[model samples]
Target: MVKKTDVLVIGAGPAGIISALTAKRYYPDKNILVMKDVKNGCIPCGIPYMFWSLKNPDDNKLGMDSLKKNNIDVILGKAVTVDRENKIVAASDGEEYKYEKLILAFGSNPIKPPIAGIDKAGIYPILKDMDYLKTVIGELKDAKNVLVLGGGFIGVEFADEFSKISGLNVYLAEILPRLLGNSFDEEFSVLAEEKLKEQGVQVLTNNKVTEFLGEKKVQGVRFDSGEEIKIDGAILGIGAVPNTDIASNAKLGIGKGKGIWVDEYMRTSDPDIFAVGDCAEKKDFYTRRRASVMLASTATAEARIAGANLYRLKVVRENKGTIAIYSTYVDGLVLGSAGLTEQSAKKEGFEIISSASETIDKHPGSLPGSNKIQVKLIFSKHSGILMGGQVVGGISAGEVINIIGMAIQQRVSMSELETLQMATHPYLTSAPTMYPIVIAAQNAAAKV
Candidate 1:
């Protein structure tokens, strides 16, 4: 049977859901159909918390209530091929879809490195599917010593959560010198490492795993230095790659980042089709060079842009580039970063000035729940424009880094930030007289 729809969206992750919802909001008269392979999907960001924070794994499920409430239709099937010449999509369910406009939000797949014995049992690669995660949870219940490969946010978070499972021995292995090395500066990475270590996580930095060791299953791992550790289970949190098999088979242009090539409006080579989320190519905000950043936040933003521009150029705001903003929490410590880091800026050949300020989040530093907040701002030395910033402190750091992101997007200058006006209350925010953001800007302005 062949189903017909004015707008067809593939994948039901954040990108797919948001794109469908936004399209409905813009073109209420258009019929939208979203085809998702998984009947029940889990929130991408909330997946890590399912290990411990969430009482039930179902708590992290991404329900279809939103699409249902909006009167959008959804189907359960995997799209096997796309006939762009006729605007038809064939799915594994033995059905065809005739789409007036198609949006691809197929998302990404976890990267499993090529190491001997890696395919052995007991090695779980993080996936967004709910049924697969349930299986992982069940298998992990019997694991005594757990090893997590890669020290990015996912690996670090998994290590932290696994450490709380009563008597589980969790080990985190990072080939880099520190955890989160690509996202944060050395100091911030060190802070995260310290917090993880405090939670009884055995962090092994500068360690390269040569191969997975086992007879029939993954029983241990041998490092390059010939050191081996026995582990009952292991998780591959290395990274993810764009899922572009369908797109490639359809003869779509792939970008340098190994994702579907799309223009500023998120339209692929075929004007009638669009791509968003991790499946689409991304460029650096400042450099305009190909970049690999797959975040739920970035995906949704692209979805909105693609949805609004599907039929016509309804939204003037085109995606300039990806800023790579990120935020993560460890124990009680929260870390947030936006744009480029100090190390990254230097490597990009930009003459920069960086400054940091430490202050309490609330007034007087004696407030009952006041916590210390540190802010770091990086600026183009010659231009004095905000380029990047990082924050560490209470939960408020999450929003604080967002404020800095806006500054970077707008190219706010150091002098302007130094005198920028903001709302403040005795209990809710830092004192106006010593705001860390303003202070950090002032310190940088002095050198600028």
Candidate 2:
């Protein structure tokens, strides 16, 4: 059977949903349909919290009410083939979809490293599918020792969540020198390591998993140091790769990072088709080189850009580049980073100056719930342009880093930030005189 739509979205993840909704908002008269494989989807970012923090796992479900209310059509099936010539997609649902415009938001697949015994039964690769996650949770209900590989944000978060289990021995191992090394500098990485250790999570840094050990199921992992430890279950958080099978089958260009290549407007090689989310290639905001950054925030931004410019480029939204903004929480501590880190900037050969400021989140350090917030700003020494920023503190740090992200996007300079004005409250934010961002910028500006 042949079904036709004005705009057909090939996935229902964050990017797909946003693109569909945005298209509907801009072109209200267009018929929009979203196709997805999974009937139930979990909030990708909230998946780790489902293991401990969330009282009910279902609370993390990606609600479809918004789609229903907006009158966007949805179909469940896997896209198998894309006939670009015919402008149709063949799906496992046994239907042929014809679209005036096609948006490919196929998302990504978790990376399962090529280690011996990796196919063991007790190993779980973090997937966005809720049903699979529920099964993994059920299997781990009585687990005593759990090992999580990779010390990235997801791995660290999973280790912290598993540590919350009354009697679980959670272990987080990273090949890098410190946790979050790729995104944060040593000081911030060490801070996260310390917090995880304080939560009773055994953090093993500079450890490489040589192999997964067991006959039928993973019973232990062998590290590069010739050390092995028994584990009841294991989780793989190495990362993910773009799912571009359909696009590749259609002969669409792939980027250096293995994602579908898209222009600034999120349009693929075939102008009639568009791609977004994890499946789309991203360029570094500074270097303009291919970057592997897969965040729902970044995906939605691309979605908005693609959706708005699909037919006529109505909104003038263009994806300049990905800034690689990230935020994660461990216990009561929240860490947020945007753009490049000081270490990364130095490694990238950018003459950079960085400054740090520490202050109480609320005025009067004696406040009952006050927390010390540390902000670090990195700037190009020659241009004085903000390159990146990191914040470590209470919940405020999450939103604080976003401000830094905006500053980086707008090319805000140290001088501009020094005189930046912001609303401050005794109970809500740090004292105006000691605002961390402004202070850090001022300190850097003085050196400049």
Best by lDDT: 2
lDDT of 1: 0.93
Model 2 alpha-carbon miss at residue 373, Å: 0.5
Question: Cα miss at 194, model 1 (Å)?
Answer: 0.6
Which ranges of candidate 1 are over 4 A from the true structure?
Answer: none
Give me candidate 1's TM-score against the actual structure. 0.99
Q: How much lDDT does each candidate structure score?
A: 0.93, 0.93
Clashing pairs in 2: none
The per-prediction tally of clashing pairs is 0, 0
Q: Write the per-residue lDDT of candidate 2 for residues 306-411, one digit (tens) a residue.
A: 9999898754599889999999999989999999999989988999999999999998777778999999999999999999999999988999999999999999
Q: For residues 191-287, write the lDDT of model 1, one tens digit per residue.
A: 9999999999999999998899888888999998899999989999999999999999999999999999999989999999999999999999999
TM-scores for the candidates: 0.99, 0.99
Clashing pairs in 1: none
